[model samples]
Target chain A: MSDYSSEDSETEFVLYRNNPEWKDVTPVKQDDGEEPVVAIDYTEAFWQYRREILKGLNKDLNIELDFIHKVILRQSKNYQVWHHRRVLVEWLKDPSKEKYLTELVLAKDAKNYHAWQHRQWVIKTFNLFEGELEYIDSLLLDDVRNNSAWNQRYFVINNTTGFTEEVLNREIDYTLFNTKDVTENESAWNYLRGLLLHDKGGLSKNKKVTEFCENLYKSGNHSPFLLAVLVDMCCEQINEGGGDSVYNLDRARTLCNELITKYDTIRAKYWQYMLDGIEKRPKRARVKRLLRAQIKHMDS
Target chain B: MFTSETMPSLKFVPELHKKYLLFILNGKLPNLESMETNRTVLMYFALAGLDILDEIENIPPERKESIIKWIYSLQVVNEEENISGFLGSTNLITKENRGKNSPYKWAHIANTYSCLLSLLILGDDLSRVNRKAIITSLKTLQLPIGSFKGAKEGVEDDMRFVFCAACICYILDDWSGMDVELMVQFIMKCISYDGGVGQGPELESHSGSTFCAMASLALSDNLHRLTKAQFTGLRRWLLCRFDAGFSGRPNKPIDTCYSFWTGGALKILNAYQFIEDPNNDQFVLMTQDKYGGFSKWVNTVPDPMHTYFGLAGLSLMNISGLNKMFCELNTTRRVHDCLKKIQEKWK
Candidate 1:
């Protein structure tokens, strides 16, 4: 791993710099000398050799930036090339091109994992968070089911500023608006939970969130994600001494039945598990409520 | 996505696939001309695919011996560099430059893993594997954070190589190659709040990486380190991966590979019982090609990697006519039994 201490350091460096030069490649005559080689451009060989060159880099060394960029343009999925590019960019102290390069690569393949990971690195290294939300919006508009875009949105919102109530509420609204028509999008659902969990109090205690969920439920809308969230809120309420059986536990149980029977059959077992938890919650809640009444009576 | 009450009549062409593996072994694979770097992994897929079909006995003894010889020829024999593991193929090595003095003396952990498994599947005695030197090479590849690179050649240190290193260590019946605490720390950092593990810290939870993490933890015997809530959350995340077939992550389309990648993770976590659904079986069957092998999606081209893993998923679900697989080692039960005998000899 320590390349500097090795005896073959010079040869290894030469291997790292041994990328094929396209200008040196030319058509060659056939063995009979009758006609020029039809497809003797050696383009495929050049690219394969270029990949070997990139793969030869050691952690302690560097490579030419132009070679790294060309290799990345040819093979965007080759994360080793991307790592080399990142190392060169940081070594040169010029990270200005990373964002543009990542964008260009993503334009070709939107869900390229290496491109996404590089984008996050570039954003953090250069503090290039401006207009990130708009970028995420564009990605989401193209495909609302893109979890990478949602994860990036979560990163940008949380890292760019403090998670105050105003920011949290705005994020909730943003996610809610996107999920209003499509409740099956796990990206937006996860985003909503991620944002709400950062708040001081949970989602059940928030009036706007509770009303929003109640309105969605009462309007005869049947999104399994929405029902699941509503059930969670109901369970939380029931566990918090909100002992209104009609509104909290009973509604949650009915929704659990709906989830198990009609919606989300893929995860019916999980819903059953949730229902079992709901059943167990009452006994614990009863014990807590009795203890609270006894303490109040003693105080009186 | 089929909504019919009856399951599809899936065909499993064991004979055609066996012939295909033989062709691949004989170097008749024009489509894989440029995949020389991944030759060892491809070989593993082919051999293991046949093993899962219980067709290893169909190969002639001489052919199996030659395959084992080819795999051994790729092992790096450097003592000074201490990187004594198997290279991917002989493409990087020439006859003129084939010793400790050779400049191309390097080994990739992933390739080493494939070579070792293929040898075990071929019933090769563990006499030739330089366990001490391979452990030393593994130590050099491990980062301070416990992640490992595939090779010493500046490759990305991610969960993939970490899993490979863990498997190599497990195969050798040795834990001296890595720092268990640091490895556990790295894996812990990879576990997202959503319960799924990622490739590294702060990355999105992915099913493949989650499997690698789980398998690494299982191999290291440190799965009990997870808190109860974390364990439950992981189970929930894995169980929720099903929506007909398993997807790698939330909102992703179901693919056949995740049937094993995610399914294998669930099996390793001892939570396979919770993943109850007839739809998973139907969806996996839907990806089977009419000729042979399985593809990532229905109606797509079939490949070796997906074919092996698809059979592996069926084996995990106890589908009839398929041999059970050892999920942690990614081998058929027969190969795993051979490995246990080898371990007994070592003891």
Candidate 2:
């Protein structure tokens, strides 16, 4: 039998630790006394250092990926681990498989922030905008309440089509359709509001959106989101000096009162604040208000 | 199961929370293994929680000195490479290579932020901090877009790092660390379609990132960067998140942490008055664990992060027995006053 020295046996079990350069390196201990608040496990410290050494050595990408996969599986929300994965994917220059990994992580926890972030990075970095809308659609179809999917839909459109006039019209219709399905869904309402604001003219300029809100309001839909959108529309008109300023201010105040009394009582103070702003019109708008008051006085 | 009617009488147990934080600081707690890399952050939650609870005196003077020394030990300064920041722990440093710089030993922006705050909470003068080296490192970490990376060559550059960098610059009273104009531009780009800010451009609007962005701007005194319409939209987005307590995103379940993330944002925006206080306070109190800590949700295990944020959320509402927190700096008014005095001295 070949003679095996103890040193060789030690080297076989311990990889980076037994290296000549690392021989003098002893992991620094935290000065926390016994039973420290944040205990530093020296074993973990050693392994962390060892991994850094291996990373410096230009280890195989597959090995690093596998290690990262295991760590992410254990701790999906760890930002550091996700950052490490991004660095590895950048090094590999092949983010083709990253989406699938993010999908796996998201499957375990649908709202995993780190996973969604990684997915966004992969899609953006590789310019993989194709079929992403369909992916978002599938996610929304499964759970229309998934705000992440709604946000992703907005992201994909902004990145791919640049949200041009045509795209804005299409998105407005799309969001309206979803809002019709779930009148109480804040995500859909927020999406519609976002689309309207992104248009060249602000919310008041979007006749289609105003008509949609008017239709919903006339249909006896008192959803707080719907009412809030109407108030926003009125405010936009008043702010832009479009249509009848006095009428829009009155309408906005009424809508705010409705929100405070019945629709969104939880945020009554916000509605009251809106009412105060409407009542305290800016100097330019106040001048318009005084003229209207004089006209009303003359008519009376 | 806790509804308005069924909720227990609201209680602010400062002593219980103080005991819990002290125990965690002096003793070990299980299930925190995942935070091994974020030791400094963990310490911040504990120390800062105690500060908010007005029980910093519980920690003996000798112990405070050791803790300060421990925090200082994690500082990594290499003036030649213009790198200076604090490590989360001494894990990467070794006995023989403790003071010498290595490629693997670099400062993490988040850790550095936590370290400065921790030192302040412990009443350290911050004179031992390497301001020049840290400021230089901060300059290098800034991306062209005005956002910052957590460290050099760090991949996770977003509003979170921007907030950390802002806090560092504000604490050190140094504006040369980052380009404020570029940082403002980056924050503007992060405004999502829904008016809430996201971690980065074109990303989903999240309450946490909204707080980070808003606080960064507030600290830099650049809140004027937001347009009037944008400010209105932001306030609308934040107010709409109230569902008993605030949620990070639309159509999401309410978590205890958003009380700080969302509430703190509103506080900075001067919109805190819009929140329904009783409902929010009840929801937060319902998540308070009887054993002495707060969790993200009801019936979940309590952790240091949520515990600190929970106390912070209460402090924002001026809950009795808790010190008033400076929402922007994530510290008590007393500690922030101390910090302000230090900055005055620097001037």
Candidate 3:
């Protein structure tokens, strides 16, 4: 049992009694003579009372959940209302309706943070990851760049226990297939990396992975997200020192320089910072000096 | 329907804006009726607006005392709960329950931060601040994972409250309340793969949380903890936020708020020079209404949040006639100057 009455000590103030939005409804007299009855709509007053109760953190369980549902319907973005709902769901031990509640809330605003957070809680508490991939797929079909949906997809895959090599490979293929036509979609690109990171074959050693990236690069799609990923892969390879020589670092630097000077002007300073980090690595010190001389000659 | 020559030229209305803020502070705003719990935050906006206009001296003497007293009334001085931070508003506190025994009273980290800042801005000596109790209360709100919930009974832990807790500690000149290493670890985990920080691990990266995390790091003096590669990634992600104005995330529409969120983050990272000043200024200017405030975008209603951020964005760009902002703290130079004096007194 929780202490609910003590929290409700702030209920001395009146609410919705003087709100101008609502008026006392008058009932029309029946044709046959009878006493005139008053018609009252208590929606605003009821909501006002519920809001005050929720604000005080009163735990009435079922009533609190109903209040939260109504509050969310009107203002889906209110964090406090959703937080109260989360507390209620945890206490009630029945999160079965949470999935549907989240779906309803998110139907109003797909990117509602509280709704997404609630859905994540539901998925974890109920192990509802089996059908999540398809749900994410439908959301992505509606808009490929829905990062919230992409984040959910990532959450489901990474947090759930069923992520096998087969699942990861299929996820990679899904990203590639969905992103084939878009010039630059950072969500799909990040998803590709997320999936690849989980693959046991590793990012650079995977034949399909390398081929997929090389083909995208060769197609003149110099997207910043794509270039950034490719450059990272090359740096990882050079750091491994698998007989590519220090020239591999030089090529990677060139790619980053191109990213700085040409394609991604927005992130030029970031590329420069990355380039400086590359030159300062202890392993690359010898080759970095030589590259500096080469750059000086080119500048001259 | 009108010709180009007949269109009214838009301009910032400083005096009318001051009056608008004062009107909101008078507690009679019908438009703000729903925000009863967040009246102190609204007070911050009004006070910050006046501070920006260099008109803080215009507050009448009695009004200043009442405002200070009102802020103190929202504080929870109870010893049993060990929660002695400021509540968001006194609307929840009634005449019948005005003592230390009121069970309805609660303190929020955000309200504490705002209360402290408002006091500092109003030139109060902060003698009334319960430094030890507030610090202890802050520690109780911290999770073992280094994040902070807003209050004891509030929602999940995230970067927003972490920033608020950091600000509270910074204002009190105390770092003992928080576990610095754990907080740093939490912040690092919040850094998304794309380099922009999220509210928490696995959440979508957002500009607001990125600002909060960066500000927290800056306040804690732990920004150097980020590796060279990590710093570059963060700088890259933040710079890429610019698309005419800025968006909180990768695919969202440009909003006026991210101008401050992303811009403040970039400034803290020391990469603000890359911001396209002219385009950003134009975008922010587009959100200005003839009525003396800035909205989230053109053709929308203006609110205190957007207005404050819009002014802050311009100030970041070295716009004339606006107060210079302390990027990490998100306060004006005047307020920071007052805080510096308070620090000197403490020393």
Best-fitting candidate, measured by TM-score? 2
Q: When only chain A is evaluated, what TM-score does every model earn?
A: 0.74, 0.80, 0.72
Error of model 3, residue B254, in angstroms: 1.2
Residue A189 displacement in candidate 2 (angstroms):
0.8
lDDT of 1 by residue, B203-318 (tens): 77899999999989988998999987578668877877888788899977899889899999998887777655765677777888777778999899888888888888888888
Better of 2 and 3 by TM-score: 2
- For each candidate, the alpha-carbon lDDT, in order, equals 0.77, 0.82, 0.75
Model 1 chain A worst lDDT window (10 residues): A34-43
lDDT score at residue A15, model 1, on the 0-100 scale: 30
DockQ ranking, high to low: 2, 1, 3
- The digit string of per-residue lDDT tens for model 1 on A66-118 reads 55665677778876568878767766688877888888888887777788888
lDDT of 2: 0.82
- Please provide, for model 3 over B98-171, each residue's C-alpha lDDT reduced to its tens digit, 9 standing for 90 to 100: 64546546687888898898888788888988888889888889999899998776456789999999898888
Query: For candidate 3, what is the TM-score?
Result: 0.83
**Model 1 stretches astray by more than 4 angstroms:** A1-71, A234-252, A281-300, B5-8, B99-101
Error of 2 at B205 (Å): 0.9
